[model samples]
Target: MVQSGLSQPEKVIGSSYNHAKFKLLTPSENSTKTPEICHAETIIVGGGVIGCAIAFELASRGQEVLLVEQSEIASGASCAAAGMLAAESEDFAHPFMAKAAHESRELLHKHKEQISAITGMDIGLRRSGFITPFRSYSDLSKYKDRRNTTSGVQQLWWDRSTVQREALWLNRDTYGAYYRSLESEVLPVSLTRAYARSAEMMGARILEGVQNVRLVVDNHGVRGIKTAKGEVCCKHIIIAAGLQGEQLMHQVGVALPSSPVKGEIMAVRFPIDQAGGRPDRTVYAEDVYIVPKANGEVWIGATSLPGRKDHSVSANSVQRLLGAASYWIPGIKEADFVRAWAGIRPSTPDGLPYIGKYEQIPGLYTAYGHFRNGILLSAITGRWIADLLEGKRAEEIGIEALSPERLNRKGVML
Candidate 1:
């Protein structure tokens, strides 16, 4: 098993956007487990970004892995996501999540070349930064202090004139704006498909169309998983089933306090000339952001709501998104709408994601509750869990603050 190192990454300076340098990784060779109705080193229940990532990491580390998904890959929130690697875009008070997200972005960069080589796909990795406007001087003051540092991020303050010159369609009503060159966006479907394909390339047995029923338990730990198709014996089991993780955890009485936070996003396509040759940066104003892909397609999103689980696209929601987008960037008002959809983000009470093994159950690890950061957090989450399985230090990933036991301690489990 080859270990991934955190090589020093180059920082994007001034205004130029350079393609990121990513390491190339080859799949490790291991003995094939003879299919005698038997074992896998790790059995992942979901095939979304998290599950596929875990499978890729485990298999690349010479573990026999099996991934079970009820449908085609990226059919859930992964499919509906408007991928934004924006840690700093989130509130600054949440340092735990901010650190995790920032690290995850770096990990994604580290694995980019390997991921592309393994999947033989682009994955749509881009370096388009984020633009957000401040409504008042108070907002600018608070953000100015935060954006002063240039160590981990490159944020440029923009006045009205600067915003107008840089952002082609920005509304004139903004007080000021801030731009960070580190925030990025990706095509969700491309990333998800590439990750799953990469896992397969790493010798993982991806069994799509099959779902895990329950954990095969013993006094020591989880021995395997019982599936509708058959039983898969495995030394370890990782439950990365987003939105469905709590239900499956409850089957074994390991209650998890997690629920679906529904979000709606609309994708629209405009003529290249209309979009100013695809304005090189992503736009984030209010609760929505517009991401322009390598192709001419643009993705605008997303509205977040708590206690909402519906995936159906609402006409009113689309209208509201369009109206708000029009208010910010008037050119979008005339753009043709291509698609609209919804996704259920798996959110816990606190913003931190759950990682590492369960307290009462050994060999049973839980990796869900990533909320909107799944796409960004996938690679590191995979590497972290792989390290845990290989008897490495848990502090190596600095994820001790995000533990499943926190749900139990806070009396929030179930």
Candidate 2:
């Protein structure tokens, strides 16, 4: 089945804001197996940003692909992402990660253009950059040397006056800021759907509402998958299944060292004639980072709670987010409160995502544990995975540092 990309995403202001009402297709107790058999060169299990990215890249390279999502695409963390491609602003734990994020941002740009040309959809991509306002000069001075360069990402310092001028609504305590134009953003679900639709346009098959998947791995390598529908034969399978896919890996023999990190976000939008208006650049203040969308909506997010799977939004989280946001950008306090929601991000033992072949199981690969960087890392994650599966060098993507085998050496894998 094929669906075209979105022409224009729905505005989140006017309507009563509701999160994506997608129900994940889970393993049914009475799910019966059928005799129907499917075939593909690579089978992707998951429909999040990473899975769609991989599917698009593989299909683009003339591979027969099958993507099976438990529910509608972008039903999980992908839809809830703030979509910040903060390669430099994030200050990754490792040098290799910084490099990966920088490359992935470029890949995202290339894919964004390709998808737009193919589907005539605007993914709400903003290259406006990031505004990291510091309330104290001491805090601002901490990154005085960051202006030099790291992983080829450069930075420009904006003095207090420059920052306040850029964002009139910003509080007076804002000492200075760092302007990183390379840091970009997008509407998360829009990009995910675009990738999936683009893959479909390239003759890749997508099966939504597919669940209860079992790997068909033999002694030699990956054979395919057995779903509730029937058998799907494939040479390789990628478990980009987010938090839920860890179970499948454990059952396959090796354990993926991953856990859930929950985050809550609130949206506050202004009328067309609002006084100061939404900040053009994303506001990455010390307390709360605010991401302003193309529309009049401003997203104040993300209270990180590790090892948390509960997606219920808490009043305390909302209060903290609002309080911090108002402290940084006072004008936002007057904006109309749209809605609040929660999502669970898959985080690994280390900071980086696990994206490489599991040597113990031939042709079996898994890519997850991106934590808050899923949107930023999705592009390269997909491309590198496809290249590796095509017999390309893993060193090109820094699999040595991001390999799943690291968990075994670290004694963290369960």
Question: Each candidate's TM vs. the true structure?
Answer: 0.86, 0.88
Evaluate all candidate structures by whole-model CA lDDT and list the values in order.
0.73, 0.78
> How many clashes would you count in candidate 1?
0
Top of the candidates by lDDT: 2
| Residue 221's lDDT in candidate 1 | 83
Q: Write the per-residue lDDT of candidate 1 for residues 1-414, one digit (tens) a residue.
A: 111111101111112111121111112323333333357777888888898888878888888887778776777778777777776676533565667678878777767788766655776678778898876788777765765343455578898888878876777777778898788776666666677777777777776666546777878888877666666677888888888888878877778867788888776777756766344678876557777775556777788888888776677777788887777777787777777777889988776677887857888888998888898888888988998889875666667777778778767554
* TM-score computed on alpha carbons, candidate 2: 0.88
The C-alpha stretches of model 1 lying farther than 4 A from their native spots are 1-37, 135-153, 411-414
